[model samples]
Target: MTDATAIDTTGYLALVRRKRLYGTLLLAVFAALMASGFYVADDRNAGGFFDGLHRIFDFPAEIFSEAFQNWRNLPGLFLKFIPSLIETLNIAAVSTLFGALLAMAMALLSTRGLALWPRLTPLFRRMMDVMRAVPEIVIALVLIFLLGGGPVPAMIAIAFHTTGALGKLFSEVAENADTKPVEGLASVGGNWVQRMWFGVLPQVAPNWSSYALLRFEINIRASAILGFVGSGGIGYDLKTALQWGQGKYDQVVAIFALLFLTIMIVDHFSDRARARLVKGGRRA
Candidate 1:
């Protein structure tokens, strides 16, 4: 190779080494901070799990014993909460659908070279950052206060959070997309929407869909938690059952079973869907 080519390769290697060093330093700093935080939390009695390590299973034992005694009531209790379970499912499904759609639009808008109004990209980026920075429960509580407690609040909160998360992921995937198609479309006088729909979206669809599917599974759990915190859905029923204590423990068990089964099914479905999307699928 020429001396000039040798100098260029040396510069590239130096840049790579610098990046690796920075990454290592950042990771070391993060680990140090985490270690210090844990120590401080333990000192302040904020580490309850560590303090109560021996008795961790005490509550579970009591719950299981009570649930066992009322085994016959489990089926009835489970059936009773089916409607509430359905409500939770609806909340998750609706939020995911809307969130995915919003995320797609935002992803296209925020991504470099893909955005119509590229100058507004930074504004959209900050907007997504704010959305994800605020906790979903915080949003849910605000909505609950304004609109009253119900599935609507949980759905909106989850959707808002999902949009931020999925938007971030989708934008990253879009960034690595082949820009040639976009340029081609633009050269042919295709509008921004046409270029995105025909050029950008087709390339990124599978990855985006995979991320959305995983987010949907996560939102199911979020919906249940939000429902318990606010109102409406099986989580609210679970809360009520727990509040009633011993006599209603069986209902709690039923709700737990339903939640577990539902999560399991969704997880399996998401895994299969992702495999099909990214791997050309396995033959059954």
Candidate 2:
């Protein structure tokens, strides 16, 4: 028995050492890959990191100097851009709303056991993957050409991406849901819609809402970028101001300030809302 125990202990120690060696090797490989990638990226970049690092604050300094000198114009500039800011916010809000609605439906349809048509689940899942794979810029640019540049194009582009993204998240959450409620509802002759509505929705609502809110924050940034591409938002104004150069720096600063403030406010509210939702979900 003593000899057997000694053999087992030796084998266990050997296994542990092997695992540790493998883990260390993996970590070393990952570090080497990261270092190589960064070196390649730096070489390919327009401005090398070391060269740009020293001047990193130059642009910000110039902009702030001008903005500070023209502090009196800040309020007027803010007022001037309020409408565009509103348009940007509207684009994000509408896209998020539509996306969340579409996501909810697609998620339900694609989820296993919860799907109304189990065979078609793969089709729906593939559709979402395609949607998510396409970048908003590509869609927005295409829509801009077809639709002639407006908030609508940006809205649709963001919504399209959001739908796929939120759908995947929603489906994953729904997959882990307790199916007892769904079975209970179905046992009473509930239809597909009824089963999902009474069974899946309640369980997934909080998580779904949290994901949607996070998507909204991302969509806001996307909408702003789309605006730069001519989708008509604060980004368009910023682009125009940037083109004018020197004297227009103040306007650029104003737009930057507004965009920054808007992002901060939205981020704060969404963070709190998500926290509340998650907490409420756990309690339920």
Best by lDDT: 2
Encode model 1's per-residue lDDT on 1-284: one tens digit a residue.
69999999999999999999999999999999999997888788855756689888887888889999989988888889899999999999999999999999999999998898999999999988988787889999999999999899999999999999999999999999999999999999999999999999989989999998999899999999998896589989888889999877788888999999999999998999998987756465
- Writing each residue's lDDT as its tens digit, candidate 2 over 86-150 gives 99999999999999999999999999989999999999999999999999999999988898988
Give the TM-score (vs. native) of candidate 2: 0.92
**In lDDT terms, how accurate is model 2?**
0.95
Error of model 2, residue 67, in angstroms: 0.5
Q: Flag regions of model 2 displaced more than 4 Å.
A: 281-284
